[model samples]
Target: MLHPCVVVSGVLLSLAVPTIISMESCEFSGMPGMPGIPGLPGRDGRDGEKGEKGQPGRLWQDKPQKGDQGEPGVMGPSGKRGVVGKPGPKGARGHQGLPGEPGEASHTDATQQSAFSVARGTATMPGRSSLIRFTNVITDFNKDYNTETGHFRCRVQGTYYFVYHASAEEKLCVVLKLENTIVASFCDHVQNHNSRQVSSGGLSVYVRRDQEVWLETGDYRGMTGKPEGYSIFSGFLINAH
Candidate 1:
């Protein structure tokens, strides 16, 4: 029988594989392989034309555009005056009143006596004597004795006043009374022959309708004079008030 020899294959089985080989060690290395060739740039594509605008939408046609803001509006005008109202009617008249009755009489006391008759005396009170009493009637005109009691009664409610004058050739004395009480007394024992005039104060007294005020004579025995003219104790009975 003859000896048989077989061969072994070392192929790199790849579609795009770089060929390589196994080698024994070398003393020096060879130069590196050349670089790959540069490739050409690709061409740019053309731009397409714009399409026609679509038909106006409903919102685009209907919506209002904002207008330029208008100038600030002019100020408002003033209002007109109102009409005057009508006047009211007049008021009614008032009713009449009834009349009043008369008043009663008035009584008075010592205050209203006359000026000349206030003092007691033997001589006359010149003009104011409604009633008078003389102690001794020596002469009609002689200053012999003016017997003023220096007092009188208040017959009515009014004012009264009393005064007196008295004289003698030598001795002189006067005594006056108010409400029967002695108010004043005077005497001039010396011969100068005093001629004195005295009067009561004008007093305001309110005596009821019919009250009494009395006056009396003194111890000197002088004449008791009446009240002055218009000097009644109760003459104020009229409704003069």
Candidate 2:
């Protein structure tokens, strides 16, 4: 160890008081302090991985629109025919109708009552209405003709057919009448002055019930003779309305 006070060769040496070296003895030990500035931000992190698949959601309400129409279906087969039903009961008879009016002429018989007369001789007066008695009543249906008066009083309303025959000596003229109306006339002259000539006639007239028909030969002169049934008057009802 070297003493501080020791000197050699006439020189003085001294020592400082601090025992060891400190930072204060270095170059910048007494400088003032200052805050540090912030640095730039770091880069953003990468995207995360995908999550698990979710469950199907439930329906909340009905759909608003109508569905589209389907195509038309095929036609069905026809059904079999059914059996016939039973017959119905008979109906009740209806009431009788009103009585009908009289029928037509076809309803009457073709062969009906007829009238006839035959005469002998009856001279008639001229300018006066006269009746020649048809002396023989051959057929007088309904007893309507009068042989004594030479008149046929009709008993039924109908169309009637009439006929007459007369024979005379010399010359004889006669007129036929219905009631007061003259209908026909006949004239006959003598043949060979003795054999006698004949005349005849026929007519269809409408005769009402109670009307009269007769033959008159008294006009101008009178009828002379009669040849049995040749001189006759006859009538019949042809039809009735």
Candidate 3:
């Protein structure tokens, strides 16, 4: 009930108790005054209530110093094609290589010699597919046989090997053409017309460049030539193409 600053601090404590008892009987103690002008900065406090989540810090074991090379990471979308890897164990046979620069001289079986044989000295009877003239040359290496065009021309261009032999006495049917296309044939039905039958034949074709080959005679011409029996026609050149 006595509040006006507590009744003015009880009347200044009874007037400062007789002026501190007359300054404690007056003596001397004075000189200490001039220091007071610094007081206006204090009003900012209100923020304190959110503090409970702090126990997770121990993971720094020291391996992190390789930095400075990073500017290349924008090319990553092409990576899904990788399942074909099983063919790698057969590679050790290589060291024999440096001897190559010397070519361009081929074709030599004596320059791809096309051969021939020919025969038929006189006993002709060729009509009914004609062409059997073969005069007689036993072995004409490059003449390519043409005893007045009985044909064997193929100036060398493939597998030849033709052959023939006749010596008949009555019925023979030799054939062996190539451009006219009969390939090969030979027959002899000489039931002993005094005995003379030799007929033979052969094949292996594929001639090309000029291509002729002959020896006809289908409706039996009975070809027996020379003195009494020899009628050949051979050919050669078994590989060139």
Candidate 4:
């Protein structure tokens, strides 16, 4: 039973020298065939040591059915700066926005002044109520009127305009106060006939902050002899409510 060891086309061609095919009356032996010429295809071995890492690829749902989305894969060489990924989850508070449409009216803040004062030389208010001491400052501009305390301080709160003038050799009267409250008056008369009297008056006022305006002479002794500023007092700041 050993002569069948040299099988040719079934790929085992070795051991060709032992020929004893008999086990007590069951077969005949050896030597009578002639078709032996086809043996040349045997040299491609040695690539078999990489089989231990094949089990980690079957975990995407044991996947074998998803085979059509694979044509976008040739751009993969820019991946080395990936460590800053922990701050992205706080964004939801935006909806109270609809009240913005009223802008264009701003006035008053350059010190807020437009003032005036006079009486630079010849003055005479010598009979009792005397505060008409505007030594001369034709426009105090935010100095708020303090010509040696003739007084007009109302640093800014609204509508003001004041004016005054007086001259009388025989009679005169003047009044214009805003803190003690008399707001405006002036008078001149020639009852006895020296006849060069003049008087003036002006007032348009709402004035609030600090509040103190002036000009007082009422019994009237004004001669106004030289008459440069002409015994006058003036004021301004007409709109700052």
Candidate 5:
């Protein structure tokens, strides 16, 4: 036992000496690698604080500001006129015309072919003698005679003419009978020894148409001269109005 204990004590002492040397070297070296770079510069700092509030104020001083002017607006329309006035006056007149000529006649002249006769003691004479009367050709004849002096008148109105000539019997003379009396006469005896007496004249008579007219013998009172009595014959012409 005593012999090995001495060998063992020698070995443990030799091992403790090396471990102490390595630890000492590591401690003495100061930390091992290079140092790092520095950081960027910082931003500028903020401004200072606002000012303090003002005191209370009036309404006029606190009023809002005026807005900008607007574009121009459109224009308005015109008004109507009042009522009108009264009427005007009239114009002048015109001129006149010229005169005209005379007019023509309607009826022509009429004539009888032969004499109309009034027999002795006869009241009415022939009808066709009315043909001389342009008015009526159908009526009776108007006649008159005087025992004193045989004469006649034209009662109707017209232009009358007489034609007288003697027959074989006696010296011929005529009296105009109208309106129951004698208006005219031709008692002058024959100028020649020959038995025929002839006379004619125009008379303007104012008798109405269709009225009567006649001729008859004369009353020879104072005559120692010729044949015993006078025979009458006559024709007439009538013109119308």
Candidate 6:
């Protein structure tokens, strides 16, 4: 009758012998029960494994603190035009100027002394362009020659010379005018009508101011005066414009 497995092993050895004698009779450890109410923040942690690349930082040697003037960059396009230079050296010679205020006395040197010489004191026979009346006055200096209008009045205005000499008996041809323009001529043709002949002439002319100059007779006038000889007329003023 005790074969039910020895009655369950004697009821589990009498309940494990009173729980091992109540944990060996409990000797000290009983007041730690007031820190148990904070447990709800633990669900975000799963990503950490990738780090290896750090070693290259050392080149800033002290001149790297000038960086606050950077806002002016956009204007560059205009450069190429230069080549032309060579011409210098030549200047030296100037100093000699002061000697001028003394020039005002030449109205042709105050009317440059005109001149004349005349002769013809009787026996005249002038006709045909007539005007040969030189009534004797040897040298009329500045009297401008005019023994009663045989004309020569050109006060002073240039080169003049004029000359004449006549003494005739039968055919003479004279002429030396200026206002009617003829300039020079003289002839004497006396084939012995009791003999006498002399006709001379000269000229230079360029007279102008009152302008007259004269001595005419073209178609033969037979001029022979003063003791039957000597007839003269002259003019002077060489240069005086």
The best candidate by TM-score is 2
Q: Which stretches in model 5 have alpha-carbon errors above 4 Å?
A: 1-157, 190-202, 220-239
The C-alpha stretches of model 1 lying farther than 4 A from their native spots are 1-151, 192-241
Clashes of 3: 0
**Tens digits of lDDT, candidate 5, 1-241:** 5779778887877887787987986766577778767779889999989989988775585669899999888876876876676656665665665666767865532232112332222222213212111111222243322222323344434565544333322343445666556667655554465444434333445455445555544542111112332233343435534
Each model's C-alpha lDDT?
Answer: 0.37, 0.68, 0.83, 0.71, 0.43, 0.84
Instruction: Please say which candidate is ahead in TM-score: 1 or 3.
Output: 3
Candidate 3, residue 103: lDDT: 85
Enumerate clash totals for all models, in the order shown.
Answer: 40, 1, 0, 0, 14, 0
Clashing pairs in 6: none
Candidate 4 worst ten-residue window by lDDT? 12-21
Which 10 successive residues of model 6 have the least lDDT summed?
105-114
- lDDT digits (tens) for residues 74-147 of candidate 1: 89988888788787788788688677787786775443332222322234432222233434332222121224
What lDDT does candidate 5 reach at residue 77? 81
lDDT at position 231, candidate 2: 62
Q: Of the candidates numbered 2 and 4, which has the greater TM-score value?
A: 2
Q: State the lDDT at 166 in candidate 2.
A: 66
lDDT of 6 at 206: 91
In model 4, state the lDDT of residue 9: 30
Could you give the candidate ranking by TM-score, starting with the highest?
A: 2, 5, 3, 6, 4, 1
lDDT of 3 by residue, 28-126 (tens): 788999999999999999999999999999999999899889788777688788899888888879888888898898765675777888888888667
Candidate 5: residue 164 Cα off by (Å)? 2.5
Better-scoring candidate (TM-score), 3 or 6: 3
Q: Give the winner by TM-score: 4 or 5.
A: 5
Error of 6 at 102 (Å): 23
Per-residue lDDT tens digits for candidate 4, residues 12-53, read 323322222335536758898999999999999989886666
Q: Compare the candidates by lDDT and give the number of the best one.
A: 6
| Candidate 3 local lDDT, residue 79 | 78
lDDT string, candidate 6, 167-193, tens digits: 888888998989988877777788887
Residue 85 local lDDT, model 5 = 60
For candidate 4, give the lDDT of residue 211: 87
